[model samples]
Target: MRAMEPDRHSYISGVLVMEKTKLLYQQMYSGKVFTWIHLMPIFCSSMVRAQIQTNSDSKNLVTHKPTPTSEALSGVTVEPTRKSRSDSERPESLSKDLFTMSNLSVSDPELEKPANGSYSDVYEKYVLPCIAEFLGTAFFIFNGCASVTENTEGTGHLQPALAHGLALGIAVAIFARVSGGHMNPAVSLGAALIGGLNIFLLIPYWAAQLCGGMVGAALAKAITSDVKFFNATGAAFKSIERDEQVGSAIVAEVVMTAYLVMTVCMGTINKKSTTTLAPLCIGLSVTVGILAGGSVSGGCMNPARALGSALVANYWDYHWVYWVGPITGSLIVGLLLRVFIGDQKIRVLMT
Candidate 1:
């Protein structure tokens, strides 16, 4: 029984050892299968991690480092980007770059020639016109006052008319170089209406004429201190006489002024007129109007001239007649010129 027990124990021990060996082999086989199955996924994951690390390193290298060309270009910058730079900080590199880009020779004479020409042209067109207004007004007032003063000795209407015409003619001739010789407001207004004058300059020219006329008249009055001449009834040689010829004077003024304005429109402003002698033609027209209408209206073709003379002489009796007649005449002539002659054609001639 003891030998059988020992044999049984040995058999049991061998069985146990066999069972342990089978379990060990099974675990090894299962571990091999598991390792094979996870091999592809692990390898792929490791490769992906390595690639991500490489890309990150490349991005970091790219971000912080500058290329050689970019670094050289940045170093050669002419102007500093700083806004609060001192005068000494001005970059020579910037100046050199600008000079190179411009490609301009330092000895170029033609570059400034056009600028000089433009300046001269501006002076001729703008400055000369103002000068003419000043000089013409002075001459007109001086001559006009002298005539009035001389005629105060009962020299008759012919003397005053001749004086007015001669003064206007001489002034126009003298100032023609500057302003095209626009001495009268009515004449200027007529020119504007027919488009002979620039519309923007219309008011400015009129203002100048008015101021000049006033200055001239005042000077004339100061020169001739004959205070008795201003009085209507006190002096034997009065500046203004209250004769019974008021109605005739009014009619004559209207007709003569209208004729004068019409002549200016036809001769100077007309497109088809062969006469470029604007100053001469206008002066002649004034002379003729005076010769014709002198006896009746004193031939006041220009209202500013008449008004200046009248104001200085203190002759306000028939003042309305002078203003109403001459202005109405000028307006009528301007309208006629626009309607029959066509303002557009006149514009071309003046230009």
Candidate 2:
């Protein structure tokens, strides 16, 4: 259930069978399960009719009617009908559990997607996910900013970089399924570019992420006593050396943001990715971004990160670099992914 896990599969299996059965009875699947269940007897009767009709011309047919018995059942090929193929042939979509295995269809034509198809589903589908994005981003930036605020010892800058990486990995592991764990606005925008998310929800995601980041940064300031150091470090991203001009900083942001967004597209956004280690891959991307460009452009691959720190610390220096660079890079990768690796093309897309 979690990206970082202690192997709770057995426990979750038990809960799945029990809780989903309850949901099935309570109409969680909108009574399609009920209809399917009631139809099974009729289906079995038809199958029996077909079987008996096929066997009637056999030379070894029983001559008289008889009561039901174990021997009679033994002769009947009364298979509990499977869908399309044997259970073993079913895809790992069954990993979602039996209730959610509503169909083996290759396309959405098998059933209408939304039973209600009303505005009410907006709350369940979009609002809750945005809430999760908010809370998860809050958790992410709070810890990450804390790391930055605490890194005032003049030691190497690796600690804050690793801290942000590890913190992001943990948050991603927790919130991946909930809201794609996109603590960064650039990542959410990238998701929108392709069709993983509804276009309407993108602004809400950005708002939640930016707000969560601001809250986290403000809270981090409250926790630390060294206001000067905290303000200085937590303000915003800046260039230090080589190509310190605005153009080079923008390039750094674009390259680093592209790397991060591209990995997310391949590892998590792409349906075909078999790697279960989304947290590890995405986190390492952040770490590498920091190590590679932290000294040059401060590795602010996420605009929300820079924006939040700037807002909290009241620092507005070079804030545009973070936003322009990341948005440009994410859009570039998003377009590339859409053309070459999107879900529409079978040769490139995952199922």
Give me the candidate number with maximum TM-score: 2
User: lDDT scores for all predictions?
Assistant: 0.61, 0.72
- lDDT of candidate 1 over 1-351, digit per residue (tens): 733543454445344433433344346345432232323333343345434554554456447544457646778633222123243433332233323433332222443455655877777766668667766876786666656664565656666566667777778777765675677777777878887777776676766676676667767667664653453211111222466677677677778887777776676667676365655667777777767876566676666666666666666666666677777787878777777664556433433
Q: Please give each candidate's TM-score.
A: 0.57, 0.64
Please give the RMSD to the true structure for each candidate, in Å.
32.3, 16.1
Candidate 2 TM-score, true structure as reference: 0.64
Worst 10 residues of 1 by lDDT: 231-240
lDDT of 2 by residue, 46-149 (tens): 34443444344232333544667786678964323212333343223232334344442222333445557566577778887888888877777777777777
Model 1 steric clash pairs? none
lDDT for residue 221 in candidate 1, whole number 0-100: 68
Which ranges in model 2 have alpha carbons more than 4 Å from their true place? Answer: 1-120, 152-154, 227-231, 240-244, 343-351
Against the true structure, candidate 1 has what lDDT?
A: 0.61
